[model samples]
Target: MKISHLQTRFILAGILLVMTTVVSGIWSAWTFAHLSEVAGRTIQKSQLTTDLSAVLSDALEREDDALLLAMSGDRGQAQKKLDAERLRFAQAFNRLKENLDQPDQTQALAQLAKHAALYRAAGDVLLTTVAPQDAFRWYYQNVNPALRRAVAACAEIRESNFRAMQRAGIRARDDARGATILVIAISAAALLISTLVAVMLARSVLTPIRELDRSVEALRLGDFERRVEVTSRDELGHLAEGFNRMAEALAEFRRSNLGEVIAAKETLEATIAALPDAVVVIDPDGHIVAQNPLAKAILVATKAQGAKIVDDLPFSAGSLRAVREALEGKPTDETRAELTRAFAVRLDGQPRKFMLTAVSIPEFQPGRCGAVAVLYDVTDFARLDELRTELVAVASHELKTPLTTLRMNLMLLGESAGNLTPRQQEILATAAQGCHELASTIDELLDLTRIESGQLRLSRELVDVYPIIDRAIISLRQRFEDAGVAVQVAAGHRPAFVLGDSVRLGMVFTNLLSNALKYSPRGGCVSISVRSDHNGRGPGVLQIEVSDQGSGIAEAFRERVFEKFFRVEQHLQNGNATTWGAGIGLYLCRQILEAHGGTILCHAGDNGVGTSFVLELPSPGTVEQ
Candidate 1:
């Protein structure tokens, strides 16, 4: 019960989500608790401090009235006021103590109590003073001051507690907010993981079903060329494997049982008739086992018998000796020998190329061994191969002279045109540009040869494509500006990086840009766009498309455009006649893209208007498959 990759992703995402949610919830709860405690403390301190101050103020006012009444010699009034004042002070003391949130404030409260008692005694002494002024002075210097100090002490306690509570509240709130953010981040991460997991599971289940459907469709179309890929040893993998085996077995059974097995004589006759060549088989007894229709025509045209052996035929002595050696198993490889010696046999009085191949037939009884010989006409392929080789060689030599002369002229123009007139300089510059293009064309030819010979080596690495595009444009910017072509490079996003040989990638872009610039008319736009999209399986990919408002490919020759040495024009004219180099730029581009596990294709560019070369490259993976 091995899970698919999609299933694994889904499970992983779910686990991440759950863990994040739980952790965030726990953190948030803890923060909230701390915040609540701090808020409670703050409220307690504020109320207690505020009420204590009001009570103290009232007590001070009553004491002042008592002093004034005694000074006026109103003894009964003074005594009554004194009594009220003492009672008020006592109430304030009790309330202050009650308001303190901590036991440490108890000592401060006790001190306030002692101070209040002392202040009351001092006030009584002043009220009954023999010298009234002395009593007033005593009240002012002792009782009133003592009362003020006691109130100040209580206020200080309240202030300290208030500050402590405020700080605590702030810290608690901050903690709570921080916890909430953590919870949110974790929850988001979890949600993302969950989504990823669901997607993975769906993909896992759907991928195989899709592949099965595709295979079935292929089978329906009479294509039995595909096999299901086993990505895992899971039940699905096993099922796919079994289904593939069944398809293979059925295909083989159908091939084997669809028709009866023909007799040896009939099989030989069928093989000869189906083959586009004359065929003859002879046993050791020198009797002809079989002769195809072509072989019978040959025998009749030469006035020979079809049932006779080759020794009786009008073939040369060398061919007869080779046949005799094949019969005796004396030839090399103990099988067969064939010679290209000419014979007098004719078909409609026409001479045609023939390739003779002979092999011994071991199924014959002892002392009756035989060999089968087949002839083929290979004149067309052999001639084309030879002519192509000659063309490559001749073109290489012919292009070299012009290339050298062009380089020399560029060098001379650059050196001598230092103080030339504007028109003169312009001509020289144009000539130099033409020379460079010719050199580039030659380089393309050489590159194609290297590619075909499997000599192209790629050194791959992670590369930033922007710099390559920038560099290519910089190298060709002057050329484009001079040609009056508008060259544009489209900004690319995704995979942010690509894996390739920078030099090779640069060459690819440079070639495309150059082609676009060369072919595009003045004021026409040549755009280079890079794109990347995920293939929905592994890492995403990056692609570059270079398009130009130039002549598009002909309908009939679209597929043949990438072939080496294939030019669009049948006869190269003056401007295009210098196609001295082998036409291999597009071919090389295709090879390079393919080597990077990418693809390059030409499409009908801009509504059958211009040519567009699209290149799709894989963001090379680390794991080698």
Candidate 2:
């Protein structure tokens, strides 16, 4: 049963094969890493050139069109268009310059930058020329050639990247073939030597190994009674003796832990039973192992007819899936959220609510685990919350109709105020203003009810947001003019697109602008800025900020402004009748933006003199994720 001379040779061959494989694997990994790095760099350069080339070329064309327009005697409009296009071109060009560093790409970029500058200079000169013919002459002679050269240089950069990618691919193909041949050669060499030694060894060498393997397998299966026999004073003899001692030690340990394990089990059972909530333990195969006395109440409420506790549980499918995932060693978000929140079960025409939780138990058997679910009755507290929300919804609905009728009556009175004295008319106007504010509050209340009821639906489409903001500005133009507050919009060459309800998004912008106009002092300016950010990772972000030159909001009140029905008391009557707002506007803005996977924040204006409402929306469908 000992390892004789031939068996020793066979063992040495195995060790040699393993060593050879390890060294070969390390070298192959390094070679593959080098090739992968080369390919990655090439692909990155190629992709940048491919994406930016089209964008830069379009910008160049647009700039050329601007020059044409300027030569046709529309210098003012042309200048604006040219500025936008130049900004676009410069952004794309600069991004490309920073990312690409290969000598050819760098040289091509330099050429493109030079030609683009020359083209821009020529366009500027054409714009300055007074005579139309002179302008046209300068544009055709200088602008056209420079634009062509710039475009050609841009193409050269793309071509250089593409060529590099091709070279990378060719080298990768050759390297892959070499790596495959090397692996095959080493594998074949090891296999031949191992097979030769194994063939030379006899069947007698496996007798003791098989005996030791059976005993180890028995130990794995908890059969500590099994032991191996030693037949010689060699390696197998020592291994057999070691396995026999291990089995005996395992048996003795089990025997000694029996009383301790019983005590622990009783303690655990006592703890579970003393709980005020229902608890159910489930094993790895979805079997219901144990339950506390309180668990019967939950089972009865749920009418749990399934074989497994998880399937019969009252949690939603998503929560159940998360629990199953956890049991499989892949925890998920719902695992925590669902277990911490209240779950409801319908029973006998009434709802029973419970706060649910789950905890994973340590392994009781090899490679297996289980989980415990606890359900604490919270029916009374949950019902109170539901009733409160329902009461608000009902009250808002009931008050809306009556308020509308009263407002209509007030409007009728105002129309017939010709017969009244001046003081009477003034009083009537004040009452009407009060009615208007009441109406606004009622509308906000109705909106709040819909949001609470989960009935706020968005009629979504890919909308060009510039027009929406333009309309928002137009609707409030007279109020801003009356306040003597100048308005500024930073328009761009491209449309800012987002997937959202146009009307709702417009409301958000209108609300922010209205707040700006309301807070701005006389002769101050309100500025609206829109910018798109793309980082080549996912869909781009669209940011819009509305700022004013009024006393800014206090830092302590900034975050609180977005809470429902919360407002700055000092600003309630800070301005004339035209400049007041209900606090729910910003709260609703936050809600609507959150529903669209976006966010809104309040910050100080650019000059720290007024409030800025910043809205960041994730653009949809334009860029790959």
Candidate 3:
């Protein structure tokens, strides 16, 4: 158990209390035990001292009786009595010496022993030497005085013992007083220590608890930022740390979520403000959330007596059907135009087109959605496209008759140049070819205008790809011969048929063939193969690859080549520059393929040799409705 954990604090506190109690208990036991030991020993020693004092006094009294008998003049009887009394006194004296511990008591007992011996000698002289008549007088003069001195010595010995006993009593009282003082002192110290321990424990515990209560109250009042200050590296400290961490996590969560949402909201508002288009934002429930000024104006003008954004903004019946699709992340091309025309609201009694573009707001919460619909003003662009197509149509049609006349005159001139020089003949031939190319270019321009104006409809039929490919090869044979390029048609399906317009697919084939020959180096080989998404045997889909063994197109510009009027590293020649073919061929090729529900891709040739163009189309049974 470490202080890092609260258990340590509790355990430590308990240990302190237990130690205090144990120490107090040990002190109490020692105090009582010592006092009991001292009391018992003192009682026993005092009793022994009193018994020895009594023995000395009794022996002295008995010796005085024997000396009285000696003064009566019975020599034999007195001698025997004296010997008995002397023996008894000597025994008591020796016992007193053994029992007495004080030095003064021992000295008094020694003096008493000497006086008893002198008294015994005086009694003997009275009995043996003095006559009975004068014995009484001699005894009274010598033995009686000696007896008195011996009794005085005995009294001194007894007094010393009494004094020793008195001292023992004083010592015993002092010992008791000391014991009581020791016990009281130990108890007071224990009480003081216990109080201190309790105060310290209460302080350590209650201080954190008070702080914790205050912090918790703040937290309850929604102050997630509130934190407890850690005072010690204990349980409360760790708890405070945990609380702080929780608060920090919550704070960070709020910052990330609320801040991003507010920022995104502001950014959206700013974006809408900046966009020229009229914008409307709506929720998944088809209710309007926000709208720009232009959007508001459009709604105000378009509202039918009383209306809302969901069902009454513009064109009826399929109103906002495209909006639902847009919310589903539909491709913009499919719905944007429809929505644009559908969103028409009369401004000054004339309807204006608005391209409706719905952008989804990110789902902040899962399974809920909102979208921003912006209506772009594409009315001018739409009119310009129409005008440009009409102009191209009129110009192409107007140039066709003259181009034909020019072609005929060149042919006639070629017939009339039989006698001309080789150079002149070559020039004549080039002139005729150039005229033919010009006529074809004008025709293609007319067709391009029709395609743009949605009038060049494909005649759906099971057209044989073999015929289209064969005709394209035959039409470009002269160019292949002129460019000295070899044409290789790989083995393909015999009756390869695709559901497309024969004339338009033929044009696509011819254009590819022409490009192959035009870009091919002298003596370079051109390869054409017809396959499918699967091999040619499977009823999968169709692919026609036209490849040229010449300078390959750079990878970056391959996709851009199909964009209208886009030329790779070249501009449309005005007058001074040499001519490259018109950039419209690949563009028209892609448009025609897409109109037939197919696509085209350009890639490096087999073995990275040259450029390859692959045209993919649905085989007969594989076309989707």
Candidate 4:
């Protein structure tokens, strides 16, 4: 069976413990058996020695009694008793000799036999020839000495057996002690081996675990190169194998994804580089984060020498404000509009027009916002617009002379109506009216062309804006009345004077008032208000607002209303039923106001019923308060 590391350790320890116990038990049993046998032999030899000593003492005592009987004159009975005693003594000596295995015991037994034979011969002489008195003397000399020698020999044999038993007991005890020591040593060795095995097994299991732990930590830190080394065929080895596999998989994943990520990054960089317009990305701190080639080129051209990319870009102050406001998550519509206007920059020793646009990038990082600024080169477009305007101006100027001659001829024809038919006169009148309308259209076109071409020079002077507004209102008063609209002028108590041409300023107000009257419903009120205030750029500015009650301009068309030739679609659909102009009136107003260092904006009226045209003009060096 395939045992796990833990199971193997347990099995080995158990086997060692069982083997140690069984061997110790067997050894103890064998030692005790050998000791018992030695003890038994010693006890039997001691008993045999004791029996031989008793037989020798009895034989000596009976021989002495027979000698006394011979001294008493019973010769036959004494001899018979002596012979029986001698036979018993010989039998005891022979039994001791058969049992005697040691050399000392055998010599003692032979000496005892020699002493008994001499004592028997001496006892027989005493019983056959000597009187009773002589018997006593002989027994005291020869027989008594022989009996003493035999008794001494028997005692020596018993002492030898006893000493042998003592030696045997001592040897048995030493053997038992040696056996105990051997068992103890074997048990100790077994325990030591088992402990070492256990420790080795534990280390075998834990070493891999520690290695795996370190590998896991490395993986967490994104280091996928380290792998666990496999060194066994147990569960720990399998775990190491799995861990190494996991590391390989992670390494592969990182390589594969890294390649794709690098590819994607290159593609993005190439795409940005291929863009036509200059693109710059800035962080919230106004530092440049990234830029395309065009952006770098533009910056190098416009920015200061030796400036770093981390520095703020060279956009106009207004554009910088818009970018900051966007980063702060605030509205930047006005600033954005200002940025979209054409601005001049020197590039390669030539002045070029560029339009800047900034937009906030979405919250890509928490609490950190960024913005993208685009610089569009519109120099060619502006030059084209200027050229087209010049061409139109030239065309308009060429048509004006013929148009004036036609108007004069029509007037002459009208005066001669008496000589003409009624149909001819009617045809002459229509021709005169058509020529007037055409002349007015030509005049508007010429004025727009002059404004776009930068040829509309202003004669600057300090003039009160109220009088200019009043003159414009009076000139358009009859038209407003015909359209069933009312005109109201409200000026501040103090006069608001600005540096501008009075005629041009009046034209601005006239166009605004005329549009208000045209778009107003019957009996709707058109109010003109002029006030003096700061216009955000500096102190001492004039603010004028013209509001009318009419169908309001849609929010979508508000910005486009100032665009050239762009009329609201709904107004165009109304056609001839409603009063309409060629749409350059508002465009001209914008150009005129902008040229005078002023601004014009259209908004919904207070009640959201009509359009409000707001004009801001910079005050002259001095303000009349």
TM-score of each: 0.37, 0.41, 0.51, 0.52
Tens digits of per-residue lDDT, candidate 1, 1-625, equal 6555545655666776677668767766776776677677667666766677567656766776787788778988887887787687777766776676555456656666666667667766676654875766676787778777766666666666666566666877787778678777766777776677667666777898899889988887877766788776656777789979978987887678656445655776687788787788888766777878887777787778644766776565656666666676654221122112224345777755455556666656676568776655545544554466457656866897978987897787679887899898998888877877777766666565456446778899988777888899998999888889988877655324678888888888887787777668888999888776755478877777889998766665665666655666664334553223345666677778888888888877887878888888876423222
Highest-scoring model, lDDT: 4
Residue 331's C-alpha lDDT in candidate 2? 39
| Residue-wise C-alpha lDDT for candidate 4, range 493-571, written one tens digit per residue | 5567788999888878888887888888998999988776555456576788999998888887787788778677545
Superposition error at 101 for model 3 (Å): 42
Model 3 TM-score? Answer: 0.51
TM-score of 2: 0.41
lDDT at position 481, candidate 2: 86
Q: Give the per-residue Cα lDDT of candidate 1 at 289.
A: 76
How should the candidates be ordered by TM-score, best one leading?
4, 3, 2, 1
Residue 578 CA displacement from its true place in model 1, Å:
13
* Candidate 4 local distance difference test against the native: 0.79
Which parts of model 4 have CA positions greater than 4 angstroms off? 1-255, 303-311, 317-355, 376-380, 406-443, 491-496, 533-539, 570-580, 620-625
Clashing pairs in 2: none
List, residue by residue over 280-395, the lDDT tens digit for candidate 2: 88887766788887676667666664436577666666657755765665534432332214677765677777776566666834687777777767888766766766787788
Off by over 4 Å in 3: 1-271, 279-375, 417-419, 533-539, 554-556, 570-581, 621-625
- Deviation from truth (RMSD, Å), model 3: 15.0
Order of candidate numbers by lDDT, starting with the best: 4, 2, 3, 1
Q: Lowest summed-lDDT stretch of 10 residues in model 1?
A: 332-341
The RMSD of every model to the true structure, in order and in angstroms, is 29.4, 43.8, 15.0, 18.5
